[model samples]
Target: MSATTDASRGKLIIPVLGRLYSSLHDAGETVLRVVAGAFLTIHGSQKISNPFGAAEMVEGLGFYPGALWSLVLACTEFFGGIFIAIGLLTRPAAFAGLFVLLVTVWFHWVTMSQGFSGAEKSLLWAAILLFFVIRGGNRHSVDARIGKAF
Candidate 1:
């Protein structure tokens, strides 16, 4: 009937729900970090094998010194992914990843005219990176261990 009646029956619904929610929230962030980090690392592996392989693509995107941009892209995705995975400089890494994903979003949307079909995954990844940019990898990260995150 009332809150007290429920407590007397040994059922504290609010406290139970609160604890469950907190646990799930923390665990969910860990899972998100792992998935985003591992996947990005894997995706970058091909380009990393030949850092300049994407030069033509970068040139086509109108970035000067195609080789340089290509190298930047390769390292950002590969190393940034690792940083994000370890929660080391998580915000910066996620921000860089966000930049890369945003470029892909624009490329897919405007250059290719593929819209959601081509950009959906990149958009999702960008959103996740954006989250990390704001949250800084949470308490489960290296940022937390070494010091309080910025």
Candidate 2:
């Protein structure tokens, strides 16, 4: 359709897909948020259970006070994931997660010398967290229910 026609339909370029998107975009975003948060939580569960299991690894990465940094990392992943999943304090939680993802990106790209191939996943995760850090949560989130965000 012409640009004017599409615009009149409340779509910019593609009215058919745009209408579909308008209907389900929020649900898609919610699913993305929940799934990403759940994956992060799962990734941290083992570390959180042990609490300091990553001490040596963190120390190797030059995070002084290995045990402390390990615990912090664990909490940042585990609890931050929970918060993000529930949409409670989403921006802060996502910001924390973004930091962790950025560290992983650095580790994979620089520390391991793995380059883009190895760092790609971390980069993607970082991007996702960065989105939440900027966008906070949606209407389906706890933040919305409680009438607060950030």
Candidate 3:
């Protein structure tokens, strides 16, 4: 049998809960997307205010033209997060966020030699952005309302 059938049939021990879950599946995804974007936005807010404050840090991470990269990172996290949260140009925004997160992953894992323990949060954020990069947004998004996605 198909996975959906298996889930809706044999696998569900509580039929009522299963039915509720089925109905709210899209809602769950929306919640995840919004929360992820919001958290990213919050994380960048201070950096965005300072703009080039991360220049030295990014240079330490081996990003040349530290000022430029720092500005890019700030804008991507701030503006990109807003875009992703509203599902406007979600894929592109998520792609940008994913790029920044990958850098953080490298910084935490390899640069700091902290391994997966330190890189865990960046890795998780990267995965979530990757999902938005692949899936764009769902029906509840502005992309859906405007009938456009990029």
Candidate 4:
């Protein structure tokens, strides 16, 4: 039988599992949001003090107009992360974060040739952002309060 079902009775087991899942659902999302947002915020804040600081490195990577891309990365990492941490415009923020993480994953794995060792952290962060993009901020989020989300 499926884990969600009782084999002997052939019935859905609603009480125990359902209650447990509901109990942890919001709390789990909150934890993911806080951790991801906090780290992204720190990384982004560092970039904000000098938005174009990465221009040389990015240009070296062949992302021409490096200054523009650098600023975009800085804003996406900082403001988007803050919006996510506060549970405001969460999906959009997560989407942006995930996009950035994907690029980092490629950079670490392919560009830097650091293999999984370098890419692992970014890959994990990408997974976290992917979850938020799909699941969205929970009921505790401002999106719920405002009654809209992207």
Q: Candidate 4: which pairs clash?
A: none
- The C-alpha local distance difference test score for the whole of candidate 3 amounts to 0.90
Model 3 Cα lDDT, one tens digit per residue, 3-122: 785567556777667666767788999999999889889998989999999999999988889999999999999989888888889999999999999989988899899999999999
C-alpha lDDT of all candidate models, in order: 0.89, 0.90, 0.90, 0.86
Tens digits of per-residue lDDT, candidate 2, 32-102, equal 89988899999999989999999999999999899999999999999999899989999999999999899
**Candidate 1 segments whose C-alpha is farther than 4 A from its true place:** 1-15, 148-150
Clashing pairs in 2: none
Judge candidate 1 against the unseen true structure and give its global Cα lDDT, from 0 to 1: 0.89
Candidate 2 weakest lDDT stretch, 10 residues: 1-10
CA lDDT of 111 in candidate 3?
88
lDDT of 1 by residue, 4-39 (tens): 544644655465565565457778898899789988
> Candidate 1 vs candidate 4: which has greater lDDT?
1
Q: How do the candidates rank by lDDT, highest first?
A: 3, 2, 1, 4
**Sliding window of 10 residues with minimal summed lDDT for model 1:** 1-10
Following a full C-alpha superposition, what root-mean-square deviation does model 2 have from the true structure?
Answer: 3.5
**Top TM-score prediction, candidate number:** 3
| Shift in Å, residue 30, candidate 3 | 0.7
- Candidate 3: residue pairs that collide: none
- Model 2 Cα displacement at 98 (Å)? 0.5
What does the lDDT read for residue 65 in candidate 4?
96
Alpha carbon RMSD to native, model 3 = 2.1
